[model samples]
Target: MPTTEPGRRRRPRASTVIVGALLTVGALVTAFPFLWMLFASVKPRGESVAYPPHLIPSEPTFEFFAQLFNELDFGRYLVNTLAIVAICMLGLLLMAAAGYGFAKFTFPGRDALFFLVLATMMIPGQVTMIPSFLIINGLNLTNTLIGISLPMLVSGFAVFLFRQFMATIPTEVLEAARMDGAGEWRIFFSIVLPMSGPILAVQVVLTFIAGWNSFLWPLIIANDQKLYTLSVGVSLLNQQIATNPSLQMAASTLMVVPILIVFVVFQRYVVQGFTLSGLK
Candidate 1:
């Protein structure tokens, strides 16, 4: 009998290649305007708007950015935005943790109370905006970081996400912890939270991005330029763009960079959080 020739197996391939390629293209397209904004921010004044514009500046300069800082109070805006983002993130983490507890643990009217909280998510932010502003104004929080962070503190979406993830934790683990005399708070803080690392990371990134990009509320509530967030500051710069497009782009550049850095760093955690939360 003739020895049979060994068969060659076709190279294995995953559809991820095609999916990734398409996603890459989509991401590039989505990112093009931002790339242009960065390029425009650094390009010489006239070049930013040259007919048939330049994607890659012939020569880039930071002069516009310098102008932005010198002429506009960009630094104050930067501080304000950073402060609000930090405060809001801290508050959101705590609120989400509490919401996770409400969903996973039993207590009198727990289900009813959680349902009431969930119902708030159905109400549009716009509907609550005016009332929230009035409350903040009444409390002398207008033009304050606390005002900006307060309405955003208890995020309904964050609560819902945390609750979903926490529900996936095994009851056996909680029972074991309880057998060892772990209180509800102890079990949640020690056992439940450690397992929730991925969701918390996701919430942090999401809440930071949302807080960082918050425009309308900041614009409405912040009357003093000293208290203006990047979004409001950039809008204020827009009114004078006819005289200074370069400066405006430079301000826009500032407004966008922090969020970009954040997304790049925490993107993996965000994806993992979505995966875990979606499971149940």
Candidate 2:
């Protein structure tokens, strides 16, 4: 056993302290924009862009938020975004099931098929945008929430994430379940999925953020004002209230809140999922 000299104590190195300070500074810098936005969101309209900007609002009010909800129909946009998120989350579960199949099943050409699926990730989304639009047009889904959400139903990244995470499961446990005569679906839904909470939380947070923040595809598909998601609706609100920085900030704050809440809640699971997946 290693022993320290009597009356001697170890202390963190100077380099460690310096690194800690630097990291603290970095975190503060990263968080500044969000702090600024929150403060600005409550400020009176004229004070938002005043010279020598203040970090704290002098006269805070909820008038801008009221305007955002009442004049801009932001409530409707929130409902549309929530509906789309629900649909996309169901699709993500299907994607996870497919990933579980890829991870656990032994099939001919399985490796080749998975490789092909991963290869799709390398293709830029822009390349398929026009073709996807044409297909949606053909289906007469234009201006519909379903059309806006169709392209986001599945993606190579989500499949790959679930596959990697699922690969970490112990095969012996699955074999034991098989010995008990459990059907494949029963084993998967009851045994496998319940044990995959971390990765599932990771997927939920990621898919929610993506679905909430989706702008371009939604804009292209849902030309109808009533069908606009929060992202599109906020952009139009910004355009109409271009001169009102307070209102813009208020709208932006609303847009950011859901994603922030999701991250704060599931960040631990995200870290655990990534760590376990990397080990696999």
Candidate closest to the true structure, highest lDDT = 2
Q: How accurate is candidate 1 locally (lDDT)?
A: 0.82
Overall local distance difference test of candidate 2: 0.89
Kindly report which residue pairs in candidate 1 clash with one another. none
**Cα error of candidate 2 at position 115, Å:** 1.6
Q: Model 1, which residues run further than 4 Å from truth? A: 1-27, 240-243
Q: What would the per-residue lDDT of candidate 2 be over residues 1-280, giving only the tens digit for each residue?
A: 9998989998889999999999999999999999999999999977887898898998899998998888889999999999899989888778888889999999999999899989999999989899999999999999988888889899888888889988989999999999999999998899889988888898899889989998888887876788988988878864775578888888899999879899999999999988887754
Write model 1 residue lDDT over 188-237, tens digit each, in one string: 77988889888888878878888888889988898776888878778877
What is the Cα-based TM-score of model 1? 0.86
Per-model TM values vs. the true structure: 0.86, 0.91
| Deviation of model 2 at 235, angstroms | 1.6
> Lowest-scoring 10 consecutive residues by lDDT in candidate 1?
3-12
